[model samples]
Target: MIISVLAAAVAPGAALLAYFYLKDRYAPEPISMVIRMFLAGALVVFPVMVLQRAVVLAFGENPFLFSFVYSAGVEEFFKWFLLYFLIYKHVEFDEPYDGIVYAVAVSLGFATVENVIYSLLDYKSFSQLLFRAFLPVSGHALFGVVMGFYMGKAKFHTGRPLGLLAVSLAFPVFYHGLYDYILIELKRYWIWLIVPLMVFLWARSLWKVNHANSRSPLRAVYSEDEVKLPT
Candidate 1:
């Protein structure tokens, strides 16, 4: 039972990581660094949980405050801080698309740990695990894509770069906050609103992926490499 729960919890994040990692066609980041980022993300969950417990004790779980401030705000801030401070200027973060790959790695790492804990402590059925895989795990991946898109734009674009950097943090917090807000406040009615929000997130995340890929300085070089391949 433990092994099964572990597998169920880990699979969704691993699958999302593979999808984003494959999207970096031009210049793939080193596996070592990506794993390092994933570990870094996983390690932060302990500190975040402590902080969130403090918030809950202080605020007494007002739904809005708990959803936005305690959950989304705190989580995204840590992920953004890690990306901006540690990974932003690294040599492997050379292309715009690399941002998405690394950010998704970190986000999934956090999600995977959270999922495992939730599964072990509260899972009532396999169906519940499936539901979490569909919403919460994928939601984290989408949020990471949004965060990374702006970070890439900030790093590569010259005009109003600071604004883009601000969005890199602010946008994810807003998206994540609203996502949790609906689930927390609306309760059983959350499905009605969350579906539309999830659709928007998927649409927007795909557009960002394409935009970041197009902006890659190495795209032309990748094209050249493809051309040189023997038929």
Candidate 2:
């Protein structure tokens, strides 16, 4: 039972990690560095949980503020901080797609850990497991993809770079906050909002993945340059 629960918990995250890993067509990031990023992401969750607890204590569990400010804001900030301060400047991060690869690694690490805890503590039924796999786990991946897309762009861009950097953090926070806010505050009616939101997130994430892959500098480097002479 324990093994099964663990497998169910991690399956969604593992699937996402695989999908993102395959997306890096130009230059794949080193496996060792990806593992380290995943570990770093998992480790950061403890601190985030502590910070969230403190926020709840101060704010007294108001679902509105809790979902938006404490839960989504704090969680996204930590994940962003980990990627920005640690993984962003690494030598391995040469191309734009590397951002998504590492970011998804970290996000899945966090999601896997969170899922395991929930599954172990509350093993209700198969339906719950399926729901969590698709919802929370996939939601984290979507948020990571959005954050990484901007961070990837920021790495190559010059003008208004800091603005892009800000969006790298802010966009995920807004999306995550809205996601949690609907589920927490809306309760039973949340499904109506969640389905559309999930659809939008998946569509946007896929587009970002394709855009980053297409814009890879390695592609140009590897392909033969075809400059036409004046005729």
Tell me, by lDDT, which candidate is best: 1
Q: Which residue runs of candidate 1 sit more than 4 Å off their true CA positions? A: 229-231
Candidate 2 structure quality by residue, lDDT tens digits, 1-231: 899889989889988888898888886888888888888878887888888898788879987788778988888888888899988888888888888898888888898898888999999998899999999999999999999999999988867689998999899989998999999888889999999999999999999999998889888765543344344
Candidate 1 per-residue C-alpha lDDT over 72-134 given as tens digits, one digit per residue, 9 for 90 to 100: 999999999999888999888998988898889889999999999999999799999999999
Each prediction's number of clashing residue pairs: 0, 0
Best by TM-score: 1
RMSD of 1: 1.2
Please give the range of 10 consecutive residues that has the lowest summed lDDT in model 2.
222-231
**Candidate 2 residue runs with Cα over 4 Å from true position:** 225-231
Model 1, residue 49: distance off in Å is 0.5
